[model samples]
Target: MVSVASPVRQSESRGSIEPILAVTAPDMKRVNDLILAMAGSNVALIPEIAEHLIASGGKRLRPMLTIASAIACGYTGEAHVKLAASVEFMHTATLLHDDVVDESDLRRGSKTARTIWGNQASVLVGDFLLGQAFKMMVEVGSLTALAILSSASAVIAEGEVWQLSAAKRMTTSEADYLAVIDAKTAALFAAAAEVGPVVAGSPEPVRAAMRDYGRSLGLAFQLVDDALDYGGSAADLGKNTGDDFREGKLTLPVILAYQAGNDEERAFWQGAMEGGRNDDAALLRATALMRRHGTLEATIERARHYGEKAREAAASLPRSPSREALLSVVDFCIDRVS
Candidate 1:
């Protein structure tokens, strides 16, 4: 069990995202330099919107995944640096676009770029970053790495559209939910880790191992975020608590809760979800329902299952510091709930 000791400090920031910061510090700086250089535009609004979100308090975990995966697979070239920057740019662009789609104001505890600059600017800047990301991928001159990331980009878009269709629909199933997140979130993670081995020309077994690890880790990360959005303080979640509820997004917690609930409980869920009720009282009732049904606890247990998959995926890799760090990353993802 996670000790509730130091709850204030623990909830203030993400502990899992903080650990490898030291090990990846130097490489992260290089990635940042590349990002800054590539983000520059003659048009003033482009840089403003891009930098606003980029400079915000995100963990940069995805790019670090790319870097760490490459290092673990024993890469020793400058290409991974550019790929890391590319991964970050893709992620930032997605955030810019996502804020617009979600109509969210706060992101990473700050006003989103779209909130400050408006949706038009946010979208255009996101496109600009995507263009820059492709340019970097081309510059790296690796077809395998390029294919992995490019396909992931397409899959992420598809996932978002699928989620858009599924939003707040009472009929949305767990299988549908998993499919959405696998495309939307986990694709890049799998690509991020696999591209490392691709860049390193590692054997197929190692490449497959890294891909599995990253995909599982990404699922755990997102699932933890889902749980936190309901049970956590606003400080624990960079975004406001119940933002997902307010947004009418159907995450695993609510999906499971709805499925397990009875006639009256199902009626409550339908009214709240379909009617778009997002008040504090409604949220209290929702939390009470989740607690009573044990859905919240069940969701966390599901996350632990994925975390175990991540660990098992790494079991066959040749032991190294990078491998150990990647393993710890899984625990860190799970530990965010603490």
Candidate 2:
């Protein structure tokens, strides 16, 4: 297995996102109130399912990014709150859809809405949340922000479809995987952060900087998630440890291992990824191969590269508590594996 003694342990004290939380707490409260209010519908199941996932203990990182970016850009208007809530709604909707698509049972240590409500209900409720998200964006009245987020929604959907195509395909390249994540994950992060500067009416350069920061941060975040799937436990992921392997998904570690494996090992990988030989024994063997090849460590190193890019982008913004907090978030994303 990959060593549990991650390099992230070197700076454990700097990994907390508390600074951003402290700076954005007041705004987050307003955003939370708006989220709850908008989530309400006469159809009881709508709110029930939405609230289940919303209140399920996710860090609300996307919305917080929006709020922090706006504040960092000197936005004093209420528009950022609406945009932040919109970003969160978009994220929540994606999660509900993802659980159904992945046939997942758990999220953030709670039963997924799909498990309790059924796939049809989960999908429709996700649609409802998307509608609510668009409504909030329209309420914000920033055409630029609306366009950015609307485009992100399309890109996220496309990314999901792309991931489905890549699933169980061992031939997937590193570039292909990066493209999948850039569309599915980084698009929202970029939108969430860019919307802040857009609503704040910051210059194009400032908006570009925040967008770059969010994109790089998002790439780092997802790479770590991919690593954790193989290297960490169920509690660390809030789901079963070997879900990726069982699902036949081709994440970074598996890709690297497949590339480095000799014929016998490659055959094992082919059988495993092709929907055969995927029991606990197979998972154990898969993890062992990854450890032998150090793919997990290499994956984390790639994540660190993106983390540094995010930090550099954050450094370009005007200095403030929010800016510093945003910088810290980059480290937190990379260091969480420790």
Candidate 3:
């Protein structure tokens, strides 16, 4: 496994990210405006669903990755705004469809688009946003950029299908879990960071560096999110606690927990994964078992390890405000609550 300098003390606290908020403050309003502008021109009905989902207030991390990577690679193009918005739209589109597949009701403490707008509307609107993303990509007119995003989308689709097929299969391994995350979560993040330099016509090595940096960061980000399902407060993390467990989706934390468990702990997991019958008490019992086995801490340590790797990946970049921003974002990933 790739490692880095001993993990830095987490700079941004979980649940309350004052430091990242400070870094993002300058770009926040403009980025929101750009995202709004991107969503405005969709067909009338689609725009309503799109706005409902977009207005639900994500941290806008994907677009932030795009703009920050562009600036870090020394790009001064205005197109970064549209590129960033395009990335956000793709991400939002995925989330809309994801909620439908997962049957998720609450996201960021609000009713999901599928919950409020119905699944059909949510799914159709998600397709519309995806079309819009491709339209924006064609507008940028970079064959390379189109290739990167197309491959990323393909990987993401594969990951989603893999997860669906792998559910409740005891054959699932850590390798399988990592494969799913790499495809589902890390692919787009890698694209978001790589596309910036591609847009700037950056050197090959620099573009490669940004892609590596974002991939590591994305892995770290997803690890923390999976871990938080058992350990995080719903009020703080902005989702229902232990929702993954309820859905019978095996994440890294659960995989590690199962590996390190004693007979009773293992039995509990077997029961939980059986036919997806996850009672509240059973999930709470499993959470307690995970804590006792230190599985959650081990999962967190792995995430921190990757966060450090992300920082190291970007360390060779020329120092600039964008470099600082990227480093801070690495810190932010491991530290964020949701």
> How well does candidate 1 score on lDDT at residue 151?
97
lDDT of 1 at 316: 72
List where candidate 1 sits over 4 angstroms from the true fold. Answer: 1-19
TM-score of 1: 0.94
lDDT of 3 at 33: 85
Query: Model 3 TM-score?
Result: 0.90
RMSD over all Cα atoms, model 1: 3.3
Q: Estimated TM-score per prediction?
A: 0.94, 0.97, 0.90
**Model 2: per-residue Cα lDDT over 1-338, one tens digit each:** 45534634455465779999999999999999999999999999999999998898988999999999999999999999999999999999999999888999888888999889899999999999999999999998989999999999999999999999998888999999999999999999999999999988899999999999999999999998898998776766767778888888889999999999999999999999985679889989999998888888889889989999999999998889999999989988887688
Please report how far candidate 2 places residue 243 from its true position, in Å: 1.0
lDDT per residue as tens, model 3, 1-338: 11111232344344333444555555656767866777775368677778877877677888888887777777776767767777888899889989999999998888888887799989988887888788888888888988998889889999999999988665589888888998999999999989989988899998998899889888988988887787676654567878888988888867887888878777778778856668888787777766666667777788888888888878878987677778878866676533
Question: Which of candidates 1 and 3 reaches a greater lDDT?
Answer: 1
Q: What lDDT score belongs to each candidate, Candidate 1 first?
A: 0.84, 0.91, 0.79
In terms of lDDT, the best-performing candidate is 2
